[model samples]
Target: MESKQTIEAVLQGKIALVTGGTKGIGKAIVKRLEQAGATVIVTARNQPNEPDATYSFIAADLSRAEEVNKVANAIHEQFGRIDILINNMGANTFPGGGFNTLTDEHWNQALQVNLLSSVRLDKALLPKMLEQKSGVIIHISSTSGQFPIWESTMAYSVAKSALNTYSKALATEVASKGVRVVTVSPGLNKTEAMTTFLEDYAQQAHITVEEMTSKLFERVGGVPIGRMAEPEETAELVYFLVSPAASYITGANLIIDGGNFPVVK
Candidate 1:
């Protein structure tokens, strides 16, 4: 059995909303926040299993401005104030070729889902945060946001760059008003969907899936940790950022790519 005391540290009294919280890293965040004593409201197109007592599920299409606003309005009406916001919703598809083959539609799709979704949610919710003079916003970005890959998923990388910049600027604009905003940029992760992507790549490359995975890892110069990150590992950083323990951290993009994006910190 888990100890009650361990469950009390990361979120004792925070009220949190995590977009895309139904699966993968977002789902892990919902669980971790619940353990720390937060009333976690998770928004996605679908609902996850109901096992955690403090968790609430809201189904909505975050990619649409109207839908994003509806979700925000619901939270504002119910809670009147939000203590934390996690912008975790994003969408992208594996590209068959490099940037030359990426169409205008693909670029627009990336921007709409990955960039504008965060913008809309923040716009709808930040006023309350400003009025309260305290809150935290976490942007779940990607390593591609900065050190982008040129051949595959290039448009998604470009969109994420906009997101990273937007997050930094928003953090500065609101920090004086007592709101903290930060970004978490993860490298390639071994989520369920990513695993499926690997299998597809293996078939396309005419090699064993395991061989394809190894070659892909090699192309990226090998993850120093020798593996892709578990969703919970990324969520743990998020748990701290929204907590009082990380009150001083704002406007910074923290990368967790197993030493894949070598930055000096």
Candidate 2:
């Protein structure tokens, strides 16, 4: 059983930085952290088009080292320090046909977007957290990191697997410094991007979207809960991990896969 008291405005006065926070899980995390009374700063390649957006937005392609430096400098000048860091900017937009179809460019792109971006940002921002002796860093990984769908996610999975290892090692190095590092591995999420991808794949396969979705479920060893996760659902777990309630949690790769992962960890 969980305690309701842990879900209050526990993040009040805290400053949080969420990379790729304009959409999907990143957007949900920004909202969740804000609702918990944290001052949130978001970064993405483009600023969102909504006129009523609230959080501070920084436009930078985190895959580039210069851009990562720019974001880090801006945050230091404006916010001084960050209480929570969510490294959630990642993608798997490469051409799919197993390892033979992937080129050096594709592999580099996947690694830059999924792994190096977070690594560089952490290098820039972690010093502040270390100085403060209290902070939380959450790396948004995927179940594919361990259970790869090679035909579709070879390079992406490889990068995420590296991220999982890095997160654990960083957590071990930083735990005594009062900075908790955690990796969150979420399974299939029903985001707009995922919906669009499914639609495209379905059209290409000459099948109904429902049929395509079911096929995906079957391919991934079936989500026992019978559905994909919502972005907000993953956000809720992130909220808890960054809160004081999770002080004892670090060096952990937590999986929220609806039982899609066949093996027990």
Candidate 3:
């Protein structure tokens, strides 16, 4: 059976830019935004044909500040304005044996991809949003940021925690201007990142990836919902945060972890 819809086309007259919006959660958010009648611009290092009629595509390497500035300039030249920006492009490294085995390069790379990339993009687009005083900036964060699964992903977790902090600070700076900044931190999302993690766990456990994945979930505290969240489930949250229903909300990092995050309140 199909799941019931949780968000409607409340963004009917908006324009959105979703970075890393090719596949996985980014793709899901792009589709949902298009369905809601928002004209979305999906960006990636390599551009793919737009999937939604109301959607467009641009190519830029977000890790490079010059490319990010170019992307912002292009959007200004072409779209004139952006009402929402979803900073979702991210990458993680394979587990590096143990905590002490990690290196400075690893930390720097993680920081660039996970946190600074979003910051650079936000800096470029934020001015216009401030001018308009009516835009939403949603950052895709991770539960590991708060939970700190350091035995496995120290760099990634730390970088995301930094991103969460940036989101809060940026939100405070712009909230009074009518521009909202918020984050959605998801856990064990069944995307490419999760697939690679399972593969690595399989190697370490000397078991099949599927078996290792099952056991890994059990070790982390079984997902109370009994399954990894689908791309659509995460996308629905992105949709709401950008919609009017969540208008008064800003600077909050909403976690969707299938009960995986052990924090209380």
Candidate 4:
């Protein structure tokens, strides 16, 4: 069996950057990477309320090119290089009434947040990884990318689908250069945002939150494990992917959906 000390220090001396790292799945990833002894840097539009946060934080709106550049420059100046990049910032805040309910603005926002932000960030930070000839880039995607809930996640899923394709292509391009790129698509996670979403959705549907939660599970083809995933559970997979343990994994889109996906890939 691996010793605790060995596992804890698996990522020692590594530098990691996790976007949208203040909450939800992003926050969990930050904690997991830090526990593995990696120096972590986080970026978000606002500072987190957590008083005991020790990770370096940079405030920047990732959707904007100028802001992305600002963050990239700051990271380069401060850390010089990054060994792990987790593109975890994403959202699905839009009207939910099928395709006609979505406007151009909504589409653009979805694309910006779910797809282009990672693209721009990768462009900005990838050079250093290429220079060093080693790095790991993980695009935190969603199961909806492949199995979109047309009425609600149309725009978000579309963007994530594009992200999935982009991740694979980027992985192929960089694999020969000693850099590894992968995508992680997680199903429903029990994060604060998810809880709030369920509450609002339940109110809108005039149903109890528990009922709404079950409906969601059914909509996703029924999780065999019978529950939503904890953010920390997803974070552990990310930790492994970014560490030396997953050295041979690249160009793969790993799904953590508790057997919800209808078919095996």
Candidate 5:
């Protein structure tokens, strides 16, 4: 294993931007990049409860086109160019109960947050990366994209699936120009938000939180690993993908689901 100092040296001069980086997997990714010696910039709708002086924070709801531009422009002005772009912002907050419960607004919101936000941000930032002829972009998607639970993940899945496709297409368009685009699909990370989600469902179902967790596993056809992933684990994968060690990789949709995605792709 490499020393932490050696790992940090891998990204000593890299500048990274992580969207929705104040919490959960996004927060973990920010920490990982910082540990790797990258100067990180974080953007989200709100500031974190405890702000760290290490990375610069910008407040913006990336679901909005204007907000996406604001973040892109601010990054450009401050950093000149970003070497690593992590599209880690996303949500599955729509009301459940399948298709009948989701309105046009829900579908639109899903698309904006999970798909178009990355698309617009890439359009704004890729110019500099192309000019330099080197950069990496990672789209943080979910395993639900290809294996959605209709009662809960209908719109969210649709948006992520589209995002996966967009990421692949973008990677193909830019591979010859020396920029790499990749999609990372994580399944059931044990983040704070996930804990709350399971708790809420447990309450509604009149079951223990553990039971609710098991129910979710069953719904997803079982996590063969028998547990949810830690956000840090996912972040490590992201780190590897953006580093030079993955130079030959592009246009790949890597799934980090602990063997939960069922069929081989």
Candidate 6:
């Protein structure tokens, strides 16, 4: 058995970059990687509510190509190379009400945030990883990529599906070069954003938050675990994937959905 200190130092001297790491799942991931002794660099549109001095922070809205380049270049200049890349930035801010409610702008924004941002960042940073012949990249996708709720998550789901495919293709291309790429499709996470969304909807519906949560479960064909996942739990999985323990795993979409996905992939 490994001592806690030894386990915590597993990633000592490693450099990790996590996007949209200011809050929620992304924030949790930053903490996890830092705890494991990795020097973590975080990028997001805004500063974290509770900032930590241990890791460096860069502010950038990754949807824009220039911003993506800036982040990549900054990391290269500061760290020279990254040992782990966690593409944890994503959102489903489009309007609900199925296809007709969505427009070209909405679709484009969805793709830009959920898919293209990672593509651009990967393109910028992957050369260093490949040149070094060692690295891990984790794409934080959503279970909606596989199980879409047409009425509400149409555009968001489409974007995540594209990300899923892209992650697999990138993994296959880079695995032989000693780099591992993996996609993590998390189910419903009890993040602050999710809580706010539920509260707003519940208020509008004149229903309790608990009732709205139950409705969400039913709409998604039920989460057998009977609850949403905590951000820390999902972060732990991301940590494991980037660690040496999961060296043989690549080109795989690992779902941490608490049994919410209806189909067996």
Quick one: best TM-score, which candidate? Answer: 4
Each candidate structure's count of clashing pairs: 0, 0, 0, 0, 0, 0
Instruction: Report lDDT (CA) for all predictions.
Output: 0.86, 0.93, 0.87, 0.95, 0.93, 0.93
Name the candidate, 2 or 3, with the larger lDDT value.
2
Between prediction 2 and prediction 3, the one with superior TM-score is: 2
- Badly placed stretches (over 4 Å) of model 6 are none
lDDT of model 3 at residue 181? Answer: 97
Candidate 3 local distance difference test against the native: 0.87
Model 5 whole-model lDDT (C-alpha atoms): 0.93
Q: How large is the C-alpha RMSD of every model relative to the true structure? A: 2.5, 1.9, 3.2, 0.9, 1.3, 1.0
Q: Write the per-residue lDDT of candidate 4 for residues 42-147, one digit (tens) a residue.
A: 9999999989998999999999999999999999999899999999999988778798999999999999999999999999999999999999999999999999
| lDDT winner | 4
Q: For residues 161-234, what per-residue lDDT tens digits would candidate 6 score against the true structure?
A: 99999999999999999999999999999998899878877887899999999889889889889889999999
lDDT of 5 by residue, 88-151 (tens): 9999988778999999999999999999999999999999999999999999999989998898
TM-score of each: 0.93, 0.96, 0.92, 0.98, 0.97, 0.97
Candidate 1: tens digits of C-alpha lDDT, residues 36-128: 888889899976766754677778988888899899889988888788999999866847578778778878888988999999999998898
- Give the Å shift of residue 177 in candidate 1: 0.8
Candidate 3 vs candidate 6: which has greater lDDT?
6
What is the TM-score ranking, best to worst? 4, 6, 5, 2, 1, 3
2 against 4, candidate with superior lDDT? 4
Model 2 stretches astray by more than 4 angstroms: 1-7
Off by over 4 Å in 5: 1-4
lDDT of 2 by residue, 56-154 (tens): 999999999999999999999999999999999999887677989999999999999999999999999999999999999999999989998887789
Candidate 3 residue lDDT tens string, 1-265: 4234434456777889999998789989999898887888989987675543457888888888998998899999998989999999887774555678788788888898899999999999999989987899999999878877667778888999999999999999999999999999988888876788788778877899889878868767789998899989999999989988899999999999898877696
Residue 69's lDDT in candidate 6: 93
Model 5 residue 70 CA deviation (Å) reads 1.0
